[model samples]
Every structure is written in structure tokens, then in C-alpha cells.
Target: MLPPELPPLPALTHAESDLVDRFLEVLDLVGRINPARSSDTYGGLRAAQALVGRAAALRDALTLMHERGESSIHATTLARALRVLDGERRAARVTLPPAGES
Candidate 1:
């Protein structure tokens, strides 16, 4: 079953709200396919890579929002979350077998 929608964050503009929603959706998928949490090895690795890509996309979106004068508070909070997801991506990469070793 799909998880419930997250409550809206404080002080977000309409455009920021949409970006946050997309970021959360990608994060939810990352959580589900996390290697430590899920037993499907190869699948987890693939999902981790996808997560990394999504997180990078989110970072770009957040940067654009900030450039367009979104609140610093919101930008900082989302940037922190993106960093956490990047850490997860790194850990997942470490768990994967070296290229040509699998």
C-alpha cells in the first residue's frame, strides 16, 4: 500500500510546494528500495542509483527556486534533506559489488 501524503511544510510558495512534493515522492521510493531495508540486492542497487539521480534533480530545482527569491529557511531545510539522501546513495554504492566482480 502507498504511504499517506506528507503534510505541507510551512511558508512555501505554490511553486516551492510542488517541488517539495516531487522531492518527497522520490524520497519515498528511495526509502522503500533502500538496500538495508529491502532484501532485493540488485534491485536495491538500481533503485539507489535512481534515487541519486532524483536527489540531484531536486537540488537543481531548489537552487533555481532560491535564485528566484524563495525563502532562505525553506531552501536550507530542503538542502539538508537532499544531503541526507546523497549520503544514503553513497552508502548504497558502497554496498554494491565492484564492477566486474558480480
Candidate 2:
């Protein structure tokens, strides 16, 4: 059985690409820190510490986009890129597990 091909990622400017990368990094860290999902406090603490820097990077990416006159977010295009990069699964990890599953 063959897996279906993923859709091609939408074209993005340097700043937009950076923004998406930074945003995903932040999401990963947040997922790690999610108390409902995390098994160890120390690991969550580490993720929380790394989150401060990842968040700053995310802010920098957004600031660069604004400074470069990328005035509006192209949500539809960005959503495609995120989907290609598995953002849905990554984002889902930030939520609590289903009842009786955890």
C-alpha cells in the first residue's frame, strides 16, 4: 500500500518562512510543557525555559515581516504550509489527552 502524497507547500517569502519555522518551534516547546501531557515536571521546566528564547525568535520573525512591509497575513497560504509540515499533529500535542486515555 502506498501513502498519499502531501500537497506542495505554498510559496513564502523569507520572513514568512522564518515566521512559520519559529511558530512551529514554539508550538513544539509548548507541547512539551503542557502539564496534561507531560509526565515529568523537570522536563516541562526545561521546555518552559527554552520557550522564552523560542518565543523571542517568533517575535523577531513577526517584527521582521512587519518591517519589510508584509502588512497582512495570508492565512490560507500559511495554513497549507503548516499542514505540509505536520503542524496539526504538533499542535494537538498541546491539548489534554482524551478522557481515560492518559
Candidate 3:
């Protein structure tokens, strides 16, 4: 189910509506794909379709999850840590400066 924060489809921004529509398409495709097919050909097709559906969630989540700045900040923090580990602490700190300071 979609979060309550989501508004009506027509009112959604381009990215939001696209994700919502893609999610719905994946859901419908999942219904049509039979995961337990006896034939190898059919089984492969179903498995691929299932994997596609799974991937769609992450794709949709990319922008949807960043609806607010909290997750974006978390991402920045993680990226900074990764950069620090890679010996780019100065760059990371510059990219993600301390929250309050100019």
C-alpha cells in the first residue's frame, strides 16, 4: 500500500506519478507471471519478470524515499564516510559540511 502522504495520482509530481504508475504495472505483471512453471522456458520468463518487479521497487524508492531531506541527509552522511575511507576526507567534508554552519 502507498503511504498516506502520497496525494492523488493526477496531483503527483512527474517523478512521483511515474513511480506510482510503474509500481502498479509491476504489480499487474507479477499477477500474470507464474513462478512455478514446469517448462524451463516459461520458468525463466516468469523468474525474470519477478526479478523485474523486485527491481522496480528500488527504482521507485529512489525518488520517493527522498520525499523529505532526512534520507537525503543520511545518504550524504554515508557518502561522506565512504569518501573518508577512500582518503578523500577533505572533499567529503566539503560536500557534506556540518549541518549548521555556513
Better of 1 and 3 by lDDT: 1
Highest lDDT model number: 2
Per-residue lDDT tens digits for candidate 3, residues 7-97, read: 2223334444444445444544443343332235665577466767666674866556577432533435344333333324222322434
Clashing pairs in 2: none
Query: Candidate 1: deviation at residue 8, Å?
Result: 9.2
> What is the TM-score of each predicted model, taking all chains together?
0.51, 0.93, 0.36
- Candidate 1 lDDT: 0.63
Q: What is the C-alpha lDDT of each candidate?
A: 0.63, 0.95, 0.46
Look at candidate 1 and give me any clashing residue pairs.
none
TM-score of 3: 0.36
Tens-digit lDDT track for model 1 on 1-102? 997665444555655665765676576667667554666778777777788778877787778878888746566755555454453454454454556754
As a TM-score, model 1 comes out at 0.51
Provide the global lDDT of candidate 3 against the true structure. 0.46
Off by over 4 Å in 2: 1-4
